[model samples]
Target: MSHHATPVPRHRAPAQPTTDYDVIIIGAGSAGLSAALALGRCLRRVLVCDGGPPRNAPSPGVQSFFTRDGIKPAELLRVGLAQLEPYETVEVRRAQVQRVKPAGRTFTVEAEGKSGRTFTATARKLLLATGVEDELPPVPGMRDLWGRGVLHCPYCHGWEVRNQPLAVYGQGKIVTGMALLVSRWAPDLVVCTDGPGHLSDNARRRLRQQKIKVNEEPISHLEGTAGGQLRNIVFQSGEKLARHALFVHPHQHQRSTLAEQLGCRLTSKGAVWINKHSQTSISGLYAAGDTTSGPQKALLAAAEGMEAAIAIHETLTREECPK
Candidate 1:
């Protein structure tokens, strides 16, 4: 099986790649779409290519953005796209960028449309806002529950499942801290190590003091409804712990290898490395959102995209359209 499934893409044909754009943004999530908006406002030629579903597509609603709080993820994108309608310089295509490489001062991107037709485009600057895919632990039904009853960030999902029976699925020192953080909303909490006992004495003591139960047994599977609503965690020893919600620190990797193929440096944590302006190690190439090494949130991604767009616009204007 594939490591993870990408989110579904919107239905659209690849835009004719006849003209070289000022900027090509390789994601249509908050980051890519926001960058397109900012660049479009500057009257720059922009192309946004959405390969697949956004990272939060499975979630019921987005959080933490002012005014947009609790808005559905797809709805947020719809609104953003509608706002870009008046910008004639901006174009969006539902295509997967399969490869990217520098060509002179510009970059060439090769993409394929939904109909399996291939197209090539060039950009003076490229933005790799392609987000990461969460790698859930290998337990039956775990993937199905993700973004539903099973989640990662407490800040994003804690309020919804607050005061419910929650469990933290992980192991080792970091997970101990994760358990503590999740306990803020889940007064009745449990930590399942899912393997060997690695929690230090102090961590165990802290969990005990907080009245959190720790289970060291490895998980066999999760029992849940067909719709992915988690109900219970089954252990190797045949014990079952009923839980209304679960939180885990899922390992993530970039959904696309375009950055890696183009020689962009990545952090030790597997995120694209970026500078102050959100530019990656490669010049004229930038990245933002969950792909970059930082706090991952929808609002933060949009802000980063705007920042990167402003920087890119300034640089392009100074070089190409200066007085």
Candidate 2:
């Protein structure tokens, strides 16, 4: 299977012919590829730099997509490529962006491939569709069951694990919101935090009314089977809580450093800051998807990407017109 990862070392490949383009997309994910398609449909020459490092590769299939719900991840990419194949002005390269710097009039990108290859390209405008990654708990046996039974998004995995024994694992302050919402999916839901979280009196009462147990012990380990399917959670107080699925509130980080490197302001939570119109602090730079400030989900990312593309089109059009 083809794979993508953040290149630890700068791997340089055989040099290829270099050229400029109307716009350069730094990722080929759901958002990045969608933006490239929209711009290309507008007759804008576009090139997408994606070493195929999609953040959702771990997902078995993409559900709740409205039109293409239940489509497998790799299948979705294949279909997207097929649709864009007729667009002669568009090109996709399997390269990961290492660094991006603005030149006198264009943006320069250095991308490294896993096969020890490096690529350089230029574009008039830059699109940051790089998504985010989840930060799991420090406890052992978590990564093995990460995407299988330990999930983060309720919209994605809620229905699958619905009505089962579920637990919400979070830090001192992160589990409350998820606990309240996940209660609807599973009747036997519990909130497990590092300690008795700073829950308001009202929240505490509401949780008790729902019969959801609240535990204050620090987590010892997220116990699970050998093949990555979660089973139970172990507590520091020598308690093993049987659970079928776990909802974790993972700390998130932006996948691409290019935005921060280009002076894109970040929210307190480290997500890229964008205006209501999806425009970032940087004039020509735009960000969307999970990288920006919002609830991270498949549909949300798609919508944000489209909205940002609209703002980008407007700005570039205004720039092209003589004031």
Candidate 3:
């Protein structure tokens, strides 16, 4: 691959003016930043718009990432930003994307800065890595202790609370599956259904085999320690079940509407649908990370971003240099 320089405009007065950037990546989390790095190294003019803190901002530390395990989420992003400074072709802006308008082969993106100033920039290709947002249960203290005592991925935080009294919150087959998965880390596990545990006979039998107890009492609220760790699950009848941590698979949705606005195909689970090459239904548009259906992890998201970059580069190369 050959590297060529493309002059980028320092500023544009028009609300929506085309830029020299070959790619415009929205959301500067792991996936977006990784793609920007790869594209920048290719000497492609790229603009990465960061939409503030990532979804993992509430988590105390990032887990399972190579050489960066247990590092704070914010710190991990800080390191990523520092490393991108050397890539002059990549410009990262602290702005939230508000709108995306596809014009033939290019896209015009409208964004609002921290100062509330709105500007627009256009690129030949656009990548959406805006991630997703988790919607927790309505029970009290759930939000307060989220990412601390309350978590979603056992692979990410299970070891931190291993061998401790744990609880999985949900009903039906989902909770049963989560309980079984969580049992790998701790022996003292229980399922809190908040009401009726709609489990099949086989599911109940499986739970009994694993020695995991089931609590079907309606929950009043969750109790947490001053340090933000979960202490107990309070039932409506005033009974409290001591627990150190809670695992849940909350419903999630895309953090940005750009994909929908651009009419990209979506999965039944509400994730942006992509082909093997990370291209969406739209020819010049792409998606990666939690924005698409699959296991959501920092390592996986970064790898997807790298793959999307390679695909985009190859496509661009084909278009610019005809055989």
Candidate 4:
């Protein structure tokens, strides 16, 4: 019998806090940590606050990332945090930032630590690396099997269950496209429209021509194994379809309310609008990663963080220089 070893969990040790810093990062995920490394390399006083669960904490491993492909999501973060240890200028705190307020040229951020104590810190610039939250379907047992059997992006999870009996949980017109996308991995596909969708007659005709099954009956619930691995789809009519995996298009929103609280402009897709340099509409505040518009990937988020950090550093340098 072949045995697989379980990866050890890594924890971030809290660092002593100071009253002021050059840059205050609101998240400690890929984007925030990457930005901290960039700023710390420049010897800028930076503090990173990590409050809640990481978005990819449930994912088994990251994919398509150069060199780090197939690495466990938690392990990748552990490596990133470890890289920051050499820089004394970068301080990390395991706390959730409760609120952020603009104070003249600086910003005041209030955060609550794990100990139930609240504290405040002021910074010349702020980076909102807080990623978005995936809103799973309200179907029973769906949330439990989210990253496992109930998945979102096709590029992310399609290959894992490739060639198996697959189904797309289509809820809207947008999901009609997702159903087609998933067809690339599993030819034997079915589009389960939980209810009547916005799909036009032409789209329905095309889907049928492709021989993909479309079931519009409301889903009663998802049946899964004890480990949350999907087994079958149970419908309102008491009919069940054997399926190994389910693809879904979920609604996403910013994990933190700080962006909305700051009056930052949002894109039509509901993400924070950011310029090429990752600067938000509000001066002295910037954003990166899933909070901003674009494809959401760990490597891409890290690159965006690097860009934002450089922009923040240059802007601060030009202003602080005695001209």
lDDT against the true structure, each candidate: 0.90, 0.79, 0.92, 0.88
Looking at model 3, which ten-residue stretch has the lowest summed lDDT? 11-20
Q: How close is candidate 1 to the true structure, as a TM-score?
A: 0.92
What is the C-alpha lDDT profile of model 2 across 110-183, one tens digit per residue?
Answer: 88875768877787677788888788878777777877778887888888889999998874445777888898
All-Cα superposition RMSD per candidate: 12.2, 11.6, 6.7, 13.1
Global CA lDDT computed for model 1: 0.90
Order of models, best lDDT first: 3, 1, 4, 2
Score residue 122 of candidate 4 by CA lDDT.
96
Better model by lDDT: candidate 3 vs candidate 4? 3
Per-residue lDDT of model 4, residues 213-265, tens digit only: 88888999999988868998999999999999899888899999999999999
TM-score of each: 0.92, 0.87, 0.94, 0.92
lDDT string, candidate 1, 1-323, tens digits: 65787877664443433448989999999999999999999999999998878989999889888899999999999999999999999999999999897876788989998888989999889999999998888888888888887989998999999999999988888788898999999999999988886888898999999999999898999999877789999999999999998999988899999888888899999899999988999999999888998889999999999999999998886665424
Name the 10 consecutive residues with the lowest summed lDDT in model 2. Answer: 10-19
Error of 3 at 235 (Å): 0.4
Instruction: Rank candidates, TM-score, best first.
Output: 3, 1, 4, 2
Residue range 109-209, candidate 3, lDDT tens digits: 99998889999998988999999999999999999999998999999999999999999999999999999999999899999999998999999999999
Prediction-by-prediction clash tally = 1, 5, 0, 0
Candidate 4 RMSD computed on C-alpha atoms after optimal superposition onto the true structure: 13.1
